[model samples]
Target chain A: MRLNLRVWRQKNGGSEGAMATYAVDGISPDMSFLEMLDTLNEDLILRGEDPVAFDHDCREGICGACSLVINGDAHGPERTTTCQLHMRSFRDGDTIDVEPWRASAFPVVKDLVVDRSAFDRVIQAGGYITATTGSAPEAHATPVPKADADSAFEHAECIGCGACVAACPNGSAMLFTSAKINHLNVLPQGSPERETRVLDMVAQMDAEGFGGCTLTGECATACPKGIPLPSIAAMNREWLRARRKVKG
Target chain B: MAVSGLIMLGYLVAHVAGNLKVFFGPEEFNAYGHWLRVMGAPVLHHHWALWIVRIVLLAVVVAHAVSAYQLSRRDLKARPTAYVHRRKRASYATRTMRWGGIILGLFIVWHLLDLTTGTLHPGGFEEGKPYQNVVDTFSTWYGNVVYIVAMLALGLHVRHGFWSAAQTLGVGNARRERLLKLLANTLALVLTAGFVSVPVAVMTGVVS
Candidate 1:
């Protein structure tokens, strides 16, 4: 298949960026989106031109490192990671527009590459359970409710991709933060610090310069892992309860 | 944000119910308005109860508007550049929230000017004549246009905002999300119908 691509190119964090068009001939429909880009980059490299730079690893789809807004949708139109999106989603003579995640918190580093470390700080705020460093407790010792465990696993599916932020008009990271908050908050082991977890994590999310959630809900829609929209609502509930706890 | 939203939501529900009383004829609707002013009479001064409620409502609106504006600025700042391409996956109501909120804000000020203060009334500027005020405001075409349009905006805003606020306040789960959405839709529809019917009634001579 022959494809036309309009890719965002920026020299550096402080440089001006624009959509640069490229034409690729003789591409396979089965080739992954990244592989198609690789073909474009390979041709550029042979011509002594700087290749397009994008982040990708563990292309099998769990790694969340691959980031791109294909055409207009994050990852791609099929609701999957960019690395997993095959060229077949497009057709011959298709003009694909790609850009890095657009969020102030996640600045563009280069062509299609963005800094998502802000998510790490959001998690570091309180996305954990306090585990005792000793012999592992018996599996049966902690009898967690099945409902709680299932809910936790549901939220745990978030891959921390900035797609939610990228897709949001307000660039809110509430979905990602809520996913982390719910993943740990629902577990029995997470109960001890539940109060502080939401308070601190939400604070961190705000401090990271991410926008407040307007509940647009595109984040869950754009999420590759299908993180449920209710996750943010649940996080809201937790935040409400935590706020009312009246910490001494 | 969630708390302030819920307070305003509660107020909207009550306000709509009060508006619906217009259908019961002027005596009842006017009496209802009068009763509201005397609600906490023995314990508080006349109109003091209404004043207290207004103060609380004012505070909630300020908080909601301020947070919304601040959040909007942060949102715009977060994306310094436009995406080469973009697609909307959220509903129309969700995406149009900002504009809907602005329309509602402007309508509130106009509504106060027309009814509460009688400054913008086309008919006699009779203070405390809530029923007459309603009839007069809707009797004018522009009044009806402004009011009906604002009601529609309010409906759309509440449709998305109610479910969202409920979700944010932790009132929903997978099992209850559908019900929450249904409630949101029902409230929006009912409130819209309740508010819009008054204008329609005036135009049709039912309330006149």
Candidate 2:
């Protein structure tokens, strides 16, 4: 199979970038999207050209590193992350346009790579349990309701791929932020820092220069893990409560 | 238009309630109007305070517009290169948001100038006659019709705007989102009819 590629090429963060066209021949339909890219890069190296730089680790899709906005959809046309996407999704003569996530906070590094350290900063703001480790307790010592546990696990599935941020119109990371907030906030272990966590995370999110969530649900639509938009609403309630508590 | 819109809605409710006093005749209505002017007497003494409120509201409006513009541009960029036909799943009100917002924005500017400042009136209002200008304006069939239409647009805009802003700001839960949606729709209908009735009644000589 032959695939026409219009891949974004940027030398560094400050450099102007454009899509450079390349043709990849003899691609296997069974090959994964990353495998196809690997074949192309092999060809580029053979021709003494700088191959496209893209991020991929654990090509199994758990690392959330293989980020690309294929055509226009983040992580390609599928709801899954880019690594999970197979080349069979494209036809023999398809012309795919690939680019890095375009957001001020997630600036382009080089080629398809982007600096998603902002997401890490947001997580570090409060996306964790503050409880200290001690002697091991019984499993049911601090049991949570089954429903709450289930919901927490659902939000916990978020891989921090930055796809939600990339897909959002405002480039908001609210879905990602809320998932982290709710993942802990719903648990008994996350209660001590609940109020402080919401306030700090929200402030950090704002300081990072991410846009506010518009509830377009595009983030959820683009999310590989199916993180619901309702989690954002939960975060909002928590933030409001936290603010009022502090003020009082 | 998210934050400023919510603020504008708050102002609208108060404004409409004040205007409804006209139904009780000029003295009561004018007294109500006089109270608003007098309520700000303490702050009114300071020239900067009034400008501050105006500036803040202006800033909020600008923020709303700027955010909306950015979102609109991003939305255009999110579509895939290949054209895939998807069914229109958005609600009617949601679909008309961009155009409705633009029209409502234009109407708000016109409204502020017409009512707040007497610029829309040819000879301006008589020294003690703010309500007179309102009556005179609504007395005209064309003016009344235009006002009614604009109010209707505002009502529709607010209907969607209220819940949309709530969701955007992250205040929505399943139960609360549904309740807010219902409340917003009901308030919009009532407010639209309330404002529209005054002009229509004035035009028909039902309110003098």
Instruction: Please name the candidate that would achieve the greatest TM-score relative to the true structure.
Output: 1
Measured with C-alpha atoms, the lDDT of residue B103 in candidate 2 is: 78
User: Interface root-mean-square deviation for each candidate?
Assistant: 1.4, 5.7
Query: Clash pairs of candidate 1?
Result: A104-B78
Instruction: Give DockQ: model 1.
Output: 0.73
Write model 2 residue lDDT over A58-162, tens digit each, in one string: 988788888988887888888898989988899999999888887778888898898999989998999988677898878899999998999899999999999
Q: Work out the TM-score per prediction.
A: 0.94, 0.73
TM-score of chain A of 2: 0.97
Model 2, chain B: what is the TM-score? 0.84
Q: Comparing to the true complex, what docking class would candidate 2 get?
A: incorrect
lDDT of 2 at A234: 86
Worst 10 residues of 1 chain A by lDDT: A239-248
Summarize candidate 1's per-residue lDDT along B1-208 as a digit string, tens digits.
6678779888988998999899898899989999998999799989998999999999999999998888789888877777768665578888879999999999999999988888888979776678988888888999999999999999899899888888877887788989989999999999899889899989999998
